[model samples]
Target: MHPIALAILLTPLGLLLRLYAILPQGKPTKRGVRLVSEPCKLGMFLGSGGHTTEALTLLSSLDFARYSPRTYIVSCGDTLSAKKAVALESLKASEILAYSVITIPRARRVHQSLLTTPLTSMQSLATCVYHITLSPLITGVHFADVLLLNGPGTCVIVCIAVYINRFLGLHSPKLVYVESFARVRRLSLSGKILRFFVDRFVVQWPELAAADSKAEYRGWLV
Candidate 1:
């Protein structure tokens, strides 16, 4: 096989191996401090288009008190998400909540040149790894108690980073993945890949839930 083909075939296997290496082994300990008792920090990934809207809508339903010092991750050049995040911060000004928005290169930009896709992917991966591993220092909070994701390829890198942190016994954040509302019939590419690793996988459509036993239908988010 050509080198490119070999690399393509091995990529998924390599990712799985990395994930396994970082995951906790054996049964959980019965004794120790509970994560629930501590104040929660939130890390959210905001995708462009409909993804941003859906994510914000879901966030609005949650209690802000439980999740503070929130950090919003957006793709580089995604001004829309950054603007929406700013609006969200304004709403929380009355509550004195802390919020920050960080931008990382996108895994692949829309209508990107096919010849440059590989280069762009590597750049995006590097950016994701940097932000995910150094989030505590950059955002002034330990790992997020809950890492929320909706759609977009960018979430894949963030999830991997979170798991890597967990494997190193540095931080263990529950990854909550929500399928996009537009995906009524099936899971998106990102959703399909994340179902295995995310702590909570939720679908917006009943049909999707029925199709994938690993996912739960929690009604429309948009």
Candidate 2:
């Protein structure tokens, strides 16, 4: 992983985690303390996909309703109404009192645009860790390319998710990647190199359903 990516990811998390330790205790503190633990600030990286619905459905199995995440990087493969996209996101954020999400009009590659794009202060993690401050989901799905399943944008997305987790005084997010075997392997050589630097890899549904039977899907994650 690039140092810029790590710096971007860690700087905020370290500061927030420190302050959270000293802040006045409240109802939020009555939650877990692990990185993205239940009742903690759980983070998610939204990649473009048709199975996004399934992904979200599977994520519902977790205790997000307990910890209450700060944001969901909503990325889509095609041009869809921002209103619809937002409505879809509202499913996850509707219950939270404080939340913010931004949709980018055009961003074919998440790595080049999203990571490089500047996030407003309101989008950053301030209220998630410190209840007195509350904020909205900072989301960006500017590109509708859906070009590569796990492209640089995915890398940037993961990097940003980790960064937000670290910045908002929360723990690193546990990623769950759900996609077809072909899509998973479509990643470019450089992209594969970057993916290697990520924390961990997980494949869901069809991608790994038959992984044990076939060698192709065995290392599909890396």
Candidate 3:
């Protein structure tokens, strides 16, 4: 069987493992509660193009002191997002806090042949697993205290990885999913999937929020 097919077939096992980790004996960590009183690590997913712009704009409204040790995740080959993240880091530099940027394989390579999509998707999944598990080992941080994400294909994979991580009792980051301003009428595909798992689901339009009672109307983010 193809590797992608194998991965897909094993997804049910992964879900079962996740459920096992969440059972009464698992002792899952609580969400939204800070593990420590000190400033915590913040992980932000920066997608290319419009997604990057909207994420940076939302960053401007956040209090840096509360979300220090910020780590920006950018898609590989997305130089624009990397450059913007670096610029934001420079502007927010402080002796007491730190900012870093990391790159991961994009879920879909630009202009990739349709026949190669499954392989690329598997590659993306491997990248997500590495960054979620091993990356933290190297960085000395188990996980981000809060993971802020917006609409993007990459965001969906990362959020799933986060959920899996939490299920394994590795970490419990408060996921905040914000729908892009462009999504005024309905949640984007990424937003819709993340809404079911994220701690907070926010929409820029009142109509979108009204349609999904679980989602909060946070006005325009960009």
Candidate 4:
């Protein structure tokens, strides 16, 4: 290689090597990165019976084992799918179960669960959890509660939960939430406002339109 070209190439490499050497080996990893790369987590879903389907689909399709995740379906729908009912059991015994068929027979509504279940019990079981919410949920008052009661948005809540774990003298845990793709023709001011807050400040692309932010285009799903 030409001397000039060689120097140019070596210069960047030298600087990177120097940086690696200078950064202390004992220097703590960022709380965020540590949590995901080697997580001790409990996955929690925060939606109705519909979310149960999405979570199962995600588990079956995604690289969930990478996170070494475990899940708990917070029954917040009217109908709970705890175990197969007699009809489903009969179908299963006959070897007629559909691959897409789920056997749980109970469903939960979100408000009812939140109002009735013990947050303390859940917190004890999970260090961190993934919360999944659907779009239709934004129309209800529960939407406001999630934004405010949880941690502004899903990502933030998870991140905050990690910090909370730290404060409680526990190791960081991974937090993940599944939100739907955006396709809203008409949005309420509150909905738009919630989206803007998320858009102006988040690591990933905003899933909704925001006047103050440009949306990022993720390539088509293969």
Candidate 5:
């Protein structure tokens, strides 16, 4: 292979390896600790249906004042989640709270063909790259300090985008994955995949936490 071609191929491979090598193992300690006085820019991915419901339920307990300037990443055409995000802010009724809703292409649609899935998934990833890197500049909101995700296919793409940002030595948020409340004994597919990638993997059930050494059981949030 030509030098430039080899460089291009090896660069990404090296980054991928680095990402895996740096992944949290056993238990994570360095990522979550921070000064309480510092305001955090929160990012959340809301999967439609039950995912959205549980995500909102988890968000309801947060102090809006602390997680100010939140960015709600939602799929295109999912007006309900967007509306609910707005409603959540409205419930706060605090003028200090600020948030933005970013709509990205869904990683996949229901009953989508396996052959076409990769193409659409790539498109979603491209959109994620744009939003993750440029949204802060465009909206004047800093990049997310912590990004929370549940069992959503689209969440994987967001995680990849964050990894890309980190690969480039840019500021990236600590990724946190929360398994759904309904999940008791087994891990959800998304949770299983994201377990190795997120900074924190939280399970609601004690059995799951015991099964996975990396998982933390923090009781049920929803």
Candidate 6:
């Protein structure tokens, strides 16, 4: 094998190792936190319908002024979610130009064939990567300081895109995953998969939290 080829192959492994080294280890803890003097760049994925409702409910409790310059990523064709986001910002009275809604291809559509899902999923990741990295340059919204995600298939793609950001040495966002309020006894598929990746894994039910060592019970955050 050529030396150049070997180096190329080894480079990705090195990057992966670097990313893994920075990931939070073991169970998560509740800690005191101070509010940032400067407004944080917030990123959130609205999965549409119920997911959107739960996520917005959680955001309603936050001081929008403190988490200014929000980026709401919605699935393609999800105008409702985008509208809801705008409505929420209006209610919060955030700065007029404080938020942007970006649409990315969905990982899988309803009734999408299993065989074709991977192709669409890849497309979703590609779009996500483009938006996460290049959109900032065009729109002036740098990669989010904090990314909040809740259940549904598309959120997983966003998580992977964030991982890719870290692998490429970009300043990755702090990933926070909130399990759905409806998931009481067990972790949802998205929650189970994201548990290992997210910086914070929150479950609304105590039993769900107890079942997963990494999950934190936050008492129904929707």
For each candidate in the order shown, give its overall lDDT on alpha carbons: 0.79, 0.39, 0.78, 0.33, 0.87, 0.87
Question: Which candidate, 3 or 6, would have the higher lDDT against the true structure?
Answer: 6
Query: Model 1, stretches more than 4 Å misplaced?
Result: 1-18, 21-38, 135-141
Off by over 4 Å in 6: 1-16, 27-36, 137-141
Candidate 4 lDDT over residue span 35-145, tens digit each: 345533234342334443444444444333243333343332323433322232343343433212211112222354555344533442243232222221343211111
Angstrom error of the Cα, residue 140, model 3: value is 5.2
Q: Residue 98, candidate 2: how far off, in angstroms?
A: 5.7
Which portions of model 2 show Cα errors greater than 4 Å? Answer: 1-38, 49-51, 75-99, 104-194, 205-222
Q: How do the candidates rank by TM-score, highest first?
A: 5, 6, 3, 1, 2, 4
Query: What is the alpha-carbon RMSD of candidate 1 to the true structure?
Result: 5.7
| TM-score of every model versus the real structure | 0.80, 0.40, 0.81, 0.35, 0.89, 0.88
Residue-level lDDT for 49 in candidate 3: 90
Which has the greatest TM-score? 5
Candidate 1, 1-222: lDDT as tens digits:
999999999999987787686543333213446476566788899998889988988887766766787889899999999899888777755367577788888877889898997788778777766776675657765756778999888788788777767756676677889998889897899998988788778898999989877787877877
| Runs in model 5 lying further than 4 Å from the true structure | 1-13, 31-33, 135-141
CA lDDT for candidate 4: 0.33
lDDT of 3 by residue, 66-140 (tens): 788788888888999989987776676666647878777887776878798778766777787777766676786
